[model samples]
Target chain A: MASLGSIATAPLRAEREGDKNAKSIVFLGLLWFAILFAVLALVVLLVTAFFDGRTRLDADLITQYSSTVFPERAGARAAILGSAMVIVTTAALAIPLGVAAGVYLEEFADPRRWYNKLIEVNLTNLAAVPAIVYGMLTAGVALSIGLPRRVVLAGAIALALLVLPVIIITTREAMRSVPQEIRQGSLALGATPLQTVWRQTLPSAIPGIATGSILALSRALGEAAPLLLLGGLVFVTYDPNGLMSGFTTSYRSRSSTGRHSHSWRFSRSHRQPLSCFWSCCCS
Target chain B: MECDGVDVYYGDFKAVCDVSLGFGYNEITALIGPSGCGKSTLLRSLNRMNDLIPEARVEGAVTFHGQSIYAKDVDPIEVRRRIGMVFQKPNPFPKSIYDNVAYGPRVTGMKAADMDDLVEEALTRSALWDEVKDKLKQSAYGLSGGQQQRLCIARTIAVRPEVILMDEPCSALDPIATSRIEDLMAELRDDYSIIIVTHNMQQAARVADRTAFFTALADETTGDRTGLLVEYDLTNKIFSSPADERTEKYITGRFG
Candidate 1:
């Protein structure tokens, strides 16, 4: 009976092999086409940027401040500084808050509760809201209370609102990747929940949190729509020194301590978050 | 030590029902049954290890040295500190071999000098001292499966718990490792009250002073499954001449 069955199925197996080889050929063809298309699009973008603006791009272009009536002399120094300040402050504020919230939601919170579901849904929606809306809210509410209008701090709070959901989502995923057995082992050894999370869970989840925070900060750095409403200039030679100094500084300083200290610290820290931020804004 | 009317439940489903048994001081008691017989569940309930699971619930009383473990305000952590556990799969932490053994003592706030001596004593008792002494700082994950299981045994001993609960400690090991662990169990009975759960009947016959056989029953109305203790006696008598027909069938390998 076994020999008869094998004879009957042999030709079907051979035919199936032929079909598999044909399907593989089609899959490889599609893969090559995708790679070629991606390369072509990248080449087109680089070539166009070079041909259209190459002559105008230089040190003077970066150094000179913008005049509303003179577009040609407008530099990106103030805009760059504004972007930097907002991103750094946002990261400083959001990472701890978002990661804590994520940890609570994933590890500690009971999903069956109504309030947790509400928070989860609201965060998802907040992530999708337009950046300009956050800017308007920050300018109207944050500035009116005590934070001066058009300073980096207000912009930071706005950007933090925009990127917090991303950090939370990524952090939750990272925390989830840690095996349940590890947590159980720690708890079984008589450690409290807080101790287990702080000692075992957090250390293992750090690499994931760092990667997510970097991605969120990069997105915040390149954002201009919210910053436009939050009052970032195209060019300012001097950097804002700190939150207080930036709020008080006038529009016409040749050199600000904020830029000097930031540049110095950037060179010193050499960490991925700092370098990645530099690449985002400088490029 | 006695477990009085102990019942374990997972959400709405009861896993083990109305089990009452006593383990003598400095004696080994083995709970043997087929797969899905609630032997492991009953074993975990002895030390309150099932508390780690979100929905697992335990009722009734487990007493250690005549003190009730399930009383209100009894700290589960304190219970676990007094009653240690070793699991089927060797789950040594991703730490050095020295750290693995030292972890329990450190948590209880033992001084460094005492911890050093305890680590050495525990490792020596488990027969793993010579194999890992030279590379005490190496990661425990680098050790072979048998060595890792023995390291777990050493880790449990370092805390100096009054009772040690083991759940299929030798199931994942080879025959040689199994023999070593069996030997260790025999040696350990001099100081600790040992309760072991194993599917291997021969292991229970060899190392256990008292053996309890458990079996599952299905409720007629609800069709819910729950485990019940079938028989309990001296290890030799239970194997050679069981009181119940079910126990005889299980012992003879005719049915489980």
Candidate 2:
């Protein structure tokens, strides 16, 4: 027992000495500095935004609509409503389509076939394409499809397209993580391929799928180029009544605020917009 | 169920060759062999479960109730519903005990009113009801290894199958749990035909009414190995007086 303790402790001492190397110490310090910089930046930004926008961050911002004539009194009611509408529509369009495509590829499609390989390669390429390019594509599509100009529906469609590849990739990875034995067990119980995927595989993968979908939605929510090209107007004073109504998103306001901050030299009027933008992006 | 001149292959390589075996209703048949001797492959072939593997192919015929199961017009799904399986490791779905048992009946569209009674009966028949009766809503993963294996058995029986194929069902279990499973198999033999694959000869002797001994034959030139059935007989005869030298050598501990 004494010799066993020495044997274990000898390795642990050697490990401790080895972990204190100059190269690793330097690398760890650099990593810690990077993390500290990020947290410090976030803390400074939130504190500044809180102090600048506290007066305007009240119930009126949620209930009142935008007004260009009285820019000081204008709130984000229309922008918030439009953001909610686009997000709901984007989720409604993207989730089922993305999950179904993932299931088909992972559970049914034969990877050996050139058709499947082609589709898979294209999906990866699509994910790498910039959001601005998707905005351009959605613009062309909206025109050809005869959609009315500056509608919330067009913005939602553009955002859905932007995030579809992300959702599909994550969902496929989630499904792939399920053990093959679980599938075999379900198949042995007389389940059809469709039934096995729907009942057994999907339920087991819900947690992973849910996590991936939230990440994808966050990515979609941050996109401004797609909304801009899809004809999201800048000065819509009224809240959107339906999907086809003219709208402006929080992203639209944030992007406009970023431009205004550079030109206005940090004026009092720009403070509220900057703070609202930060809160919208972070929250 | 019966296999007639059945040959199983993975792409071009033969796994099990020319196996002609018949199973009587209400009897337990144990397939015993060394590892890689294709006992599990043969069991999967009986219910057309090998169809799930893209590379696996079967020649000749496997029949159920005198109907060829692999016939082009027949659905493999229908065959599996009547012939369920249990794996080496207990694989209860990550679900409540009640849902695990109800899965088969629900997928196959049994009446909702009869599901509770059916689930209870299956749990009782597998001898798991006494231990898990109160925690029916708990996840099957919370059960011990032995209990999980028994839960799998209950799930298999819940489909109202005429045949049950078990591949090393008790290999991961303790001796006491093994005996419990053996006793349950003996009781179940009165209701359903069972085919079990085991590396343990003692287990075969304990629970099986009939035993089939499979051995691997190696070709020296190509270094190819194929599993072939050597002898099948009553359990007592196979253990006490094996006809083949290989079977005798294996049982008497001369060689694998």
Which candidate ranks first by lDDT, i.e. highest?
A: 2
**What is the C-alpha local distance difference test score of candidate 1?**
0.79
Please report, as a value between 0 and 1, the fraction of native contacts recovered by candidate 1. 0.28
Expressed as tens digits, the lDDT of each residue in B1-256 for candidate 2 is 8899999999888999999989889999999978888899999999888988888999988999999999999989889999999999999898999999999999988676788899999999999999999999999999999999999999999998999999999999999999999999999999999999998999999989999999888878877788999998999999999999999998888875
Q: Candidate 2's residue-wise lDDT over A1-283, tens digit each?
A: 4675555443434546576889999999999999999999788766765665576677766777665455455667777788888888889998989998988999999988999999999999988899878778877877897877578778878888888998899889999999888888888888888889989999888898888888888888777778777768866778789988998885223234445421111234344675556544543
Could you give candidate 1's per-residue lDDT for residues B230-256 as a string of tens digits?
998899999999999999999899983
Instruction: Enumerate the candidates' DockQ scores in order.
Output: 0.45, 0.77
Model 1, A1-283: lDDT tens digits are 5676566544533445654687799998999999999998667645655554566577755566533445445455554565566677889989999999999998899877999999999888888888889878888896678767667777788788888899999999999998776676665666567767887788889999999999998888766667667665434555666764342111222222324222211232234453446534643
In candidate 1, position B45 carries an lDDT of: 83
Model 1: CAPRI class: acceptable
Q: Which pairs clash (backbone N, Cα, C closer than 3 Å) in model 1?
A: none
Q: Where does candidate 2 chain A have its weakest 10-residue lDDT segment?
A: A261-270
DockQ of 1: 0.45
Model 2 clash pairs are none
